[model samples]
Target: MIDYNYVLRNHILTHNQIGNASDKSNTQRCDVCGTFLSSAYALKAHLQLHSDNSKPYTCTLCDRRYSSVHSLRMHEQLHTGEKPFKCEICGKDFSLRATYKTHMFLHSGERPHKCVLCGKRFKLSSSLKMHIRTHTGEKPHNCDTCGKGFSTLGNLRRHQRIHTGEKPYKCTECGREFNQSNSLKAHMHIHTGENLPKYDISVIIYSLS
Candidate 1:
């Protein structure tokens, strides 16, 4: 006959040892999720679920993708009517971080994207892509209305707006109209007077130009 109490005590000690070992390891393989990741990254990603503070990457064209929840938050600026990034040339305001980064080249006169045909330099790759469409005569953005076509989806969407008059972006506070949701969200800040938390400050500064 085995000593059940002694076996239980040993099992408890073994569990504690395993727990301590897991705490010390920088990376671990999760048995439940079958994910192998660094403890810090895993913890940060895990914590994103508890609160609304986690996106770090955002797509300016659409509110469809987020690199991190922290990134999605900064993207809310587009809807809030906040233009932290300003352009010296036209005094234009940009809502997206990546757009601001692209705009910096205009002031610096740094044309990294060059045209092979005419050697024309552009500050942004997307601009270069659009310019190339002109040379290629390739209109990717097709309008369902009147079977029209455009080089950029933005142009096509704008054209479509003329027909539908549909503005999906709405401000929670004032019910303002916008093409993008980020703009509306940013507008709500005026009513709420909310500020970013300390932990998110670094992420905001890093993402914003």
Candidate 2:
């Protein structure tokens, strides 16, 4: 007589053990990119970036090469100085349509990206992703020069100006320069006598009361 139930129980236990072992092994993460993969095959695919010989897509103008064709196309835009996508509202242009679409959100105030945890809305998915980091306390962007960490890449880029001493924004009025545009605008207010937009607050107060 065959003990079918006992045989099935053993088989299930063995399968669970194998799954647990596989999960534990998956904890081995890539040191270079910090990517975690479940299997050896996936890990090997990710580690291809560490290999210098595997960059198949090479840029003709620059020494930069990528493993994917899509990345190569994006890099080639810098060499060609191509601005194919144009905005209908502001007449501004972008090299990629995705960039132009994101820019359109600024004029439309159309915040489509919403946070799943906090119910907060953002104009862009990148903004939503950065907002999520506030809850997680994850500062992934780090400066190699100072070992300082920032929550967003924009903040990190601004911080790098301190090390590089780069003042990119300039005021046309006084020929004053600043590392950021907001600083230049604030300085401009000194000359322009606070060009703040006038608004009637009494109507809003009466409605609220």
Candidate 3:
């Protein structure tokens, strides 16, 4: 099972980022479900790959469609019940592979994506692209309303809410609304009356299953 909260956080942090630049990748693959997205901007619309809304991939076995092919495959697993990620080398499937894949990068010491401007090394070409922007002062993401610039598309959308007065996030308990997700999370404390507990993301994912 996917820890949706963890996925949400990752989406909030990395949704503006595209595929690793040096890798010549186009997809912002979901870290949770391995769904390939052509654009980083589409992450929110997919709802962490678990939402019922806007599902385009349909299962021929049933009426259910899903936001991603990965999701559709997982759902079809309910009928057939097989699963998981195959290691590229040995071809053994694992329940989880994100950290394992990163570990391989470390084992090889292969951070191929380097910034030409600063000699900074990154495992992801996306990170390298973002780093390069710091030197070039490029703001590819711009606000249509105010003509303001942001380094990332996520930041641009977040800023746009100020102009539009739109609040998409709401407290489930109090029904109070907020323009940002972080604000909604912080407001949730009023109902719980405690600080959120710190749990390893793996622990949360384990509980979800």
Candidate with maximal lDDT? 2
The 0-to-1 C-alpha lDDT of every candidate, in the order given, reads: 0.62, 0.71, 0.65
Model 3 per-residue lDDT tens digits across residues 46-110: 54457556677889998887778887766776677454665576565544344356546655878
Q: How accurate is candidate 2 locally (lDDT)?
A: 0.71
lDDT of model number 1: 0.62
Model 1 worst lDDT run, 10 consecutive residues? 12-21
How many clashes show up in model 1? 18
Over 97-153, each residue of candidate 1 has an lDDT whose tens digit, in order, gives 788878787678898987664578888887887886666555645677787868788
Q: List, in order, the clash count of every candidate structure.
A: 18, 0, 4
TM-score of each: 0.34, 0.53, 0.41
Q: How close is candidate 1 to the true structure, as a TM-score?
A: 0.34
Candidate 2 clashes: the total is: 0
Instruction: Between candidates 1 and 2, name the one with more favorable TM-score.
Output: 2
**What local lDDT score does residue 79 receive in model 1, on the 0 to 100 scale?**
73
